[model samples]
Target chain A: MLSVNVRLFGTLSRTFEDYHHSCGLDIAIASRGDIHDLLVHLDLIGESIGMVFMDDKQVNNTTKLNDNARIKIFQPIFGG
Target chain B: MNIVRVDMNARKITREIFEPAFTGMGGRGLTSFFINREVPPGCDPLGPDNKLVFAPGFFSGSTLVNTSRFSIGAKSPMTRGIKESNVGGTVAADMARTGISAIIVEGRPNNGQSFILKVDQKGDVTLHDADQYWGKRTYDLVASIKEFYGNKISITCIGPAGEQQLSAASIQATDRDGRPCRAAGRGGLGAVMGSKGLKALIIEKSATNAEPIQDLEGFKASAKIFAKAVMDDEFSAEILPELGSAVLVEPINAAGAFPTRNAREGQFEDADKISGEALAQIIKSRGGKPNHKGCSGCIINCSNEYVDEKGEFITSSLEYETIWSMGGMIGNNDLDSIARLDRLCDDIGLDTMSTGVAVAVAMDAGYKEFGDAKAAIEMVEDVARGTAFGKILGHGPEMVGKHFNHDRVPVVKGQSIAAYDPRAIQGMAVTYSTSPMGADHTAGWVVDSNLEAFGGTLDPFSAQGQVENSRNTQIHMAMVDTVGICDFAQTGFGAPDGLENVCKMIAAKSGKPFCEADWKSTGKMIIQTELEFNKNAGFTKEQDRLPRMFYEEPLPPHNKVVVIQDDDMDSTFAF
Candidate 1:
């Protein structure tokens, strides 16, 4: 079992919980599962995520998320 | 049109006819024009030769929304470069009402005596003795001036810091509540006003029958549409009034670009303490007003008055830049402390953003501890007193950095970076680097696609296509400024035909046949003029580069440095 910690920001923070509490992903995949696939398995729309981060490093939305990696997603919204 | 010249040294008021070429330009264009034509490069900015010009935009007195901004221009005593700062207040509209185009203060008072310039509807100007009001704070001075001139008149006054000729001094303007809160607050223009021996400028509402626009009905039609669009928009209608500009805290913090602790880190650990949500809660608990209040003829009022827990006034118009500078940047999340600091800046006539950055830099240099809100407030108070350390901080961010021997100062071209950190918002980085005005975020603020379809990379962290996005936004911003409207109205420009409607509005007001091409041409012309002024003022491509700290420090979360190369910076000016 692989557990991925997810955090949301901006409009995503407003719409979804900052931390997803014990969400289960149906896929049992290798280390090469892209973020798009992860979102798809979680029933999340790709357009809602503007930027993605994995392990404190900014990665493209298409970049793969490793097992036990911490992922942060930001929606397209501006303040000020 | 006339130029009212106030000579504080000789206590003389002279009126001169406005040149025809300067007939249409106001606000930024008028100030930039005056600086370019009149001010001698390399002249002592504090000396009598440097002049400060105050002009209202063309549509300032009309029914147009967000058209009430006034511009103040002078060769900066701090940066020793061209400076133009604008603020929203009733004074600009009142000036237009008095059948005056602009007021130019030339030469200096031979003696150290300060005076006030008073103007009435009959075009009469008087230089009154202001010795009694010299050292008074902005609030006290405004109250006294109002008592003397009646509440109907609008006055722009400087505080003790300006009277002392502090380099970071600002000129304060009264808001609707009669608080000296709004400011023409940048580039030490208040010092220029002080150098001329002027304490304040009082403008009585015009009794003359003068209309601002040529075609009233046509202008009214277009302005109504524009105002409706602004008021009807979800972002402007919903978020702005509720949060003011403090709404930016969370997103910028998330992007690792919130400018924490004098730019040492891009994100603040205590951002939640000062976020817009937090501010809303405070306002609700304290029974503070949260709706938009107009400056003059503005219907889309984005300004608010914030009150403290004891029902005491803290500050009016708590903005995003102020929140970021005093809260996140200094690592002080105390809203009350931030409000007090803001009030200090307002009362003393200083730039809050620059002063905050200076204080943060001082803290980094071991002059004060991080998150020392009281100490930070004290340092700002020193600026008013002209104390030894206050003098250092009053010189602005670059000088303060040098004084403290801090190498991590985030300033470009001697001006401190605004609230947005460039490493997080790459388009903003381009704007800060390449803008003629050093490190001004408003030069080209990037609107999110959801807010406005500015059409750029959805991901702010990506450098790809940011330069082009910035350039396009800059052009649009120039057009907005030229039209004398607030950039907050930009959400309406998202529609395909929005630019055409803007042109239509201009055509109706000026009686000129303006079209989309005309708008583009005017924007290009404004940019070219600014570029020419900078070039003549000895600014080169080297000055356009970001500070070295951005390249060295890897911002957290993203852990990415400002990777835009010098070549990319050079290419920005290729246009």
Candidate 2:
């Protein structure tokens, strides 16, 4: 059992939430499951969501997740 | 059907019949064609041999939404290379309505006297004395021209930097709100215009009965479909209109692709201060409008005019690239100061992106401190004034880097890179490297990973599938530029089959038959022609490379260096 949190920004933020908050996803996975599998378990699709961070350090979508590792996901939006 | 040639030396205007080869091409294609056809290769870009071309897209006068883009082309005095800068304004539509396809300004004035070009109905062109408007900024100069030519005339003008013939000068265009807000702001086209002793071009919207299209109804149907797709798409409709393009700050920052501190890092510490949310908040608090505003017949209305606190005017069309280049890339997070600097760049006829990069390089050289908004504003002002240091800054990032002895300048083929750092977004790295224009993001913006999800061995991080993606995107963008449509319209209709309807519309209008594949081929042909022009002008595969610093420095967040090998870069153009 592990806990992960996600937050959206820009278009996703507007469409999802006003500020960063916990996603509150609790799931039971086999030992040594990676973050990619966790994202699938949490129903995240492709690069539609841009950056993923684990405990403040940037990580790719395929990064492995540890027990009780905090995660955040942000979606793409416009800028110059 | 006619080409207007304005000889600055003789102050004479000559007209010639248009050739069929140049019938459909306009904007970038037209500029490139003119440069390749008329200007001699290896000629001094700042000398009399160099020619400046102003051309509107083929469908500029039509009811096609957001099709009012015009291009300015010149052998760049800045890059000493081929240059084409495009902008959205009413001048293109007005020129099309007045039955003019292109305007070619040639030869410098022998006596060194400056003048303005006035074109009205019946194609009458006059060179008016512009000594009084000399050294005036574009904002004030535009107002003076409007006051004299009446409110309806479309004017393209330059400013003090242009009058000084600085290498970084841009050509200014009037936006919907009558501000000199839009610009062809790259490669010092304004310097070319200024070298011709031209101050401004005032075009009167003529009521001439010139209908070039053959099938209006079919064209209208195709245009409607294209417009519907853009208006209905989630990205174009909801996001672009609501936030303009500046909304990418947060996402690109989070992705660690945002260029910061002169491309030294991919993330900004003050990202939240310059985020799109901050911009939206400012717009809402100041009673500013954030909806889509059209350029000519455009319905997408992705352009914005933002006002600041104290209810004073700030800037128009506050874009994402400009914000990033001036804000994060330079390490300046003051929004109001950034807006003021944007206005200064617009008034001086300079590319904000290049200017921002140059200023940051200046800061990195210890000329100014990082994140000093006041110093940044003063440095830009110095460029407008053409001071000694200003000349260094106005020459662009490469020159600035050279003068400062900084080896980490992030330029490709002498032109500064856009907002996205190549070390972070490797797909855009391919674009910056291989693009003929050199470091241009619009050659192909490869951030569209959500488009139908084509499964393949195409990895975004590695340079594995970037070549094909860049080639495909270049073709698509070329088609969009030719039709005078906004690139945002392609979000809904960028696919091969989607372009079929657009080509059908073009065919109907031109009384020709064009299929989906024909449209695709047209894009390929445009790129091939551009590539040939660049190759002839001395560009080679060696020029198609990212700066060495990108390969050396590991960007933050991801902390990944661009590990693309030289041979892999050579294979990008393997066709």
| Model 1 stretches astray by more than 4 angstroms | A1-80, B19-24, B206-212, B292-294, B447-455, B458-463
lDDT of 1 by residue, A1-80 (tens): 45566655333333453333224122454567777776765556734555566766667747877888877655444432
Give the lDDT of residue B131 in candidate 2.
88
Give residue B285's lDDT in candidate 1 (0 to 100).
77
Find the 10 residues in a row with the least total lDDT in model 1 chain B.
Answer: B449-458
Candidate 2 shows a clash count of 11
lDDT of 1 by residue, B394-488 (tens): 77778888987777777877788898788766777788888777787777787463122223444666666777777776766665654456656
Tell me each candidate's TM-score. 0.88, 0.90
For each of the candidates, what fraction of the native contacts does it recover?
Answer: 0.12, 0.24
Weakest 10 consecutive residues of candidate 1 chain A by summed lDDT: A17-26
- Which candidate wins on DockQ? 2
C-alpha lDDT values of all predictions = 0.74, 0.77
DockQ per candidate: 0.15, 0.24
Segments in model 2 whose C-alpha atoms lie over 4 Å from true places: A1-7, A13-80, B206-210, B292-294, B449-457, B492-496
Model 1 docking grade: incorrect
